[model samples]
Target: MNFVYEKMMGGKKGLTGFLILATLILVIFPLFLDIFRLNLVGKYLTYAFPAVSLVLLWGYGGILSLGQGVFFGLGGYGMAMFLKLEASSVENTKIQSTPGIPDFMDWNQLTSLPWFWEPFNSLTLTILAILILPAAFAYIIGAAMFKRRVGGVYFAIITQVIAVILTILIVGQQGYTGGINGITDLRTLNGWDITTDSAKYIFYFINVALLLGVILLSRLILTSKFGSLLLAIRDKEDRVRFSGYDVSNFKIFIFCFSALISSIGGAMFTLQVGFMSPSFVGIVPSIEMVIFAAVGGRMSLIGAVYGTLLINFGKTAFSESFPELWLFLMGGLFISVVMFFPNGLAGLWDDYGHYITDRFSKSKKTKEDSPEIVEKKSDESAA
Candidate 1:
């Protein structure tokens, strides 16, 4: 969809979105859902962060990154490291050979903490790493690819390979990263036990708050001239270059921004889910992230959140009831959505909903006018 910046991405439309999200977060979900279900929605909202970024990158910037999982993993593991350090205090690990180190490290026969893990002992440093590491990695990747005009399928392939490589590295380094199991047993953030239901409730609100901020940020960007430039680059990169814009710089910026968004989601995921695993940092999950954006309406920021919720809800429902058919069903949904509704749920609504609403309004107006017309006719006949 070629989105008109003024029409779709403007602050007015974003305000409507903000109100809807605020209502859902502050009123609807809290009042309607039990804690368990609310937490599940929180998990779904976390994925929406990355999905919104994908809408920026793929839908507007025309950059399809298949390695978003790597950034997500980096952010998640960054947070996980700090949480693990807190959980593995000397008192907690008194039975371990290395009482001050993480239990997994002790299990693997390590005597001292790895140098890389040292920084994570500080929460401030961990938060900084979570933000910087992903953006730095994205900068390198985007600079290398966009500068050389490598994009589309080739860029996508490279990203997919990167995801696979990172997954292998994390899984292979058992002693360092907890291997295929990834980071687990995270108990607390500071002194507050994050595993408690109360904590989950708090984190859910936090997730919603951050996600809303991101949506507003994205809307601000998309409504700006730079957003038009991105759309132009997506449709006509060579023309944009001919027009004297630094296309590669814009690409790099969007790439880094997308990474930042994905990382934030990852960090929030770790907080809510209580674990960060290699399973989330791989090709399958990375692609699934894109599917969330596509299913929502790649050009619609607010639509992405609803899309993630609906898809995840369906996945959870189907997988629990008919495990064997869930994959087939999900695959079919993806295929059918792409094939039949290229613009996704938002597109469908825009196309048919306006027509329905217009018809309803016209009918109601005619009904009101009929009473006035009949009253005038009776007065004229009496005269």
Candidate 2:
């Protein structure tokens, strides 16, 4: 048990992993990739948040909530609300009958902002809502489900339903939620134009920094006693429960934590991508996000980021060259990952990598022992 824990925790191997991740996100990509490609990578990196969170929930805790998109959308919409409000300032919306409100509101024949959007006017509150709202929603769902012992596929189905309901609500309420198009035409954030190349670069670094912070936090959790409990719950819920741990509380906490992480990504996506739409708040995107986690290795948090980047990169390349084949390729990739590499790219690396390392060590030792063995044989012959 100690050996397993040491291997999983931040020993030499973990430090090497962290260093590789840091070098890629902080140094290599920024130095080599162009501004356009870098920004695109930034967008892909945003998806990594949910992927990493899914690793914690599914790989460790065995709780698969398929409605992560709902939380992601909620977080994006929270930030989008603030940015949209700023963009719809009196000067920007002078042509509208209700100049200060969102243009969508004016188009829908509304005169003022809704009660809910009023709170987003404050930046601090918007930030808080980005984290709090999704966690709160997750808490409600998780509490209800886990407390009732309704888990596995049932919890997944309920979460999917929640995602569908959110998409419908956003699309149905065009005036308030920006409808099918989502909140667009966002130019500036806090009076600084975010549409410029310089701002994109700034936001990219900010996104990378936040991602690293999340990775570190997740590492802390996985190395702690709580992480052990989560693993126990995933493997043997009955045993843990009999051991006196509130398994439901851990589930709720992890679910909410995953929601909060995903929301932060969504908020960053709005800032970098400059839009928030119902397209992301649906079942399809949520499932794809899970694929991202699965492809990365549900057990490896850093692998989640690489998995998202690789998948998105493949998507862009395929969609550009063979638009019709993109979906087929993606479906095939998902199927292959599940069928062949259930633990993902990370698992493959751990398997073959350790094997190769062991072989090399054995060869080196044999070489070193050859001289000593020959010397011993020479002495016996002399005797």
Best by TM-score: 2
lDDT, residue 174, candidate 2: 99
Range of the 10 consecutive residues with the lowest summed lDDT in candidate 1: 4-13
Predicted candidate 1 versus true structure: per-residue lDDT over 1-383, tens digit per residue: 23534434453334445566679776899999999999999999999998999999998999998888889889999999999999999999999988989888899999999999999999999999999999999999999999999999999999999999999998888999999888899989999999899999999999999998898789779877989999999999999999998999999999999999999999999999999999999999899899999998999888788779879988998899989999898888888988998998778766765565567678887886897887997999999
Q: Kindly provide the TM-score of model 1 when superposed on the true structure, using C-alpha atoms.
A: 0.89
Cα shift from native, residue 194, model 1 (Å):
0.7
- In model 1, pairs of residues that clash are none
Q: Candidate 1: list runs displaced more than 4 Å.
A: 1-14, 352-383
The count of residue-pair clashes in candidate 1 stands at 0
Q: For each candidate, what TM-score against the reference? A: 0.89, 0.90
TM-score of 2: 0.90
